[model samples]
Target: MYAAGLLNYSEHPMKVIIDTDAGVDDAVALFLALAAHKDPKCPFEIIGITCVLGNTGVDNVCRNVFTVLDSTGVSNIPVFRGADTPLVQPFIRGESPFFGVDGFGGVHSLPNIPVVKQERTLEKESAPLALVRLAREFQGELTVVALGPCTNLGIAINIDPNFVKNVKELYIMGGNSHGVGNIRPCVEFNFFVDPESAFVVLSAAWNQKIVMVPLETCKLAMSSMEWRKQVLGTIKSSCSISLKKGLLQRFEKDYGSWCSCDAVCMAVLLKPSIISKSSTNYCTVELQGAHTRGQVVVDHPQKTGKPHNVTIIEQIQLAELERMLLSTFHPSTFI
Candidate 1:
């Protein structure tokens, strides 16, 4: 079900700026956002996309974004190039093997690809500067959807401390919980790649209306391969043949189910009701520890005097999310 107040904002779709590192999951999130933008029922308008370093380098991110934009026929949404590495750490590369050689699950080389790149010159802007500018322009209205390392956001906050206070909210796809990890034994990939930046961004202020989608929640909320097959199989009329083919290939390679870590965060923003359970907590990233570095620590007030800074989504309404995903990615969908 859609959020109660979504329709009320139809006259002015909620303006959003997506900050991502453009990996396979990030690519799916981008496409989901594009699909949502086309839905009159979902109040979201992607104002711009900013790239940072996480899954791949900034250069590859830019190229991948351009390729998606061309394929989806989404025009005029400017994409900015941001930080190439974490704030205080050396650039970490070659970590995620699931995304394969291209960080896109190796689908770019598939035979008879229907999505063609549009011939156009690309101009770029600094990601942090773009963040600052867009925040000022849409003060109290802009919502930032962060899908990668927090470098770009931390830099923006450093440049302008009020950047966080000025924005509407931040929907972030990172961190881990329940003692699970994708990179190290205790850290998610995004936070592990740039823990310093995550620390800076997460601990910047006492209260900032941030919603975190961690690894454990993603693992349990929507991990059914049968559900994926049912949804993808029935959506042939809604998705382009190329995208459908690509997604099927991705599912096949993964042995059916895909967790959708990043895309699920995007889904929450469009329909807040997708979350069946959650908690507000004082959250911060661990900067030091031989085995626990990059782990996001959520402490209770009794343990720490600090107030809660984030709303940790511990669970989600999976069936509702599946419905939302189906509607958002249907091929007839246009942005």
Candidate 2:
């Protein structure tokens, strides 16, 4: 796959921009990214973080991102605010039920944690436009890790036709591989919230891999809450400690089974080998049917002669995930 003089990624730091809606798990993903960035051996460098509407309103998401950064003592990465609403509909008002009222399990209200608003961010630049600018600046060296609805990314593609070409790759955490839905009968939450944008991002010809860690694949991380609360909770590290604060309410809510949907995406990004099984298929979001809107329709039969647009991860190694989680939560175990 080497073209003439193209430099290998190992030769330079692979630039990454995290586009997220700061839910509880989104905070976990950010903690993982921050840990990787601190490592000297890691090949990727986080350039910036973008906010979009998803688990909560865009404004809340932006604030929540700052909260994570503040909690982790990271001040360099610039947070860019993006689309407050989906492509077709206005964003849902008020906080979501999953991540408590404040999206971080009301962590900001905790006495130990200070209220952190949008700080140390590029307020002038919009998120979608920022994505376009970053892609051109980094050229083929940039990877966009999407952790929420595809609204911001879709707008970026619409902004610049060359966006997909300039960017090296995309890693998304959304959709459902088995037609199982969290928000609707056949639709996943992120896609269900914004089907138009999901369809747009999936249909594009990126010239690089679009690795999607859908719901079914993500559910593989639901192994043991005991391991999470005890093993991982005992790990005394800045990242882990900070993440624990965000996950306080979650432990009681989803106690028996534990699954950080977005964190699985981060783990896959950190170590692709963890993906023991995957299927490269033509994947698209359904936007028309009354009950089927936002469902991910994968061409498993290979009837669509079109080139595969996305690599749908079917399974991951749970053992490998545990190893990566250790490294992510405790940076010293990066080996």
Candidate 1 Cα errors over 4 Å, as ranges: 1-12, 109-113, 120-122, 233-256
Best by lDDT: 2
User: For residues 190-224, could you state the per-residue lDDT of candidate 1 as single tens digits?
Assistant: 88888888898888762365899998888766556
Q: Which stretches of candidate 2 lie over 4 Å from their true place?
A: 1-12, 91-96, 109-119, 241-255, 331-335
| Residues forming the 10-long window of minimal summed lDDT in candidate 1 | 1-10
lDDT of each: 0.75, 0.78
Backbone collision count in every prediction?
3, 0
Q: lDDT tens string, model 2, 237-272?
A: 444434553565555565456777898898788767
TM-scores, one per candidate: 0.87, 0.88
Model 1 has a clash total of 3
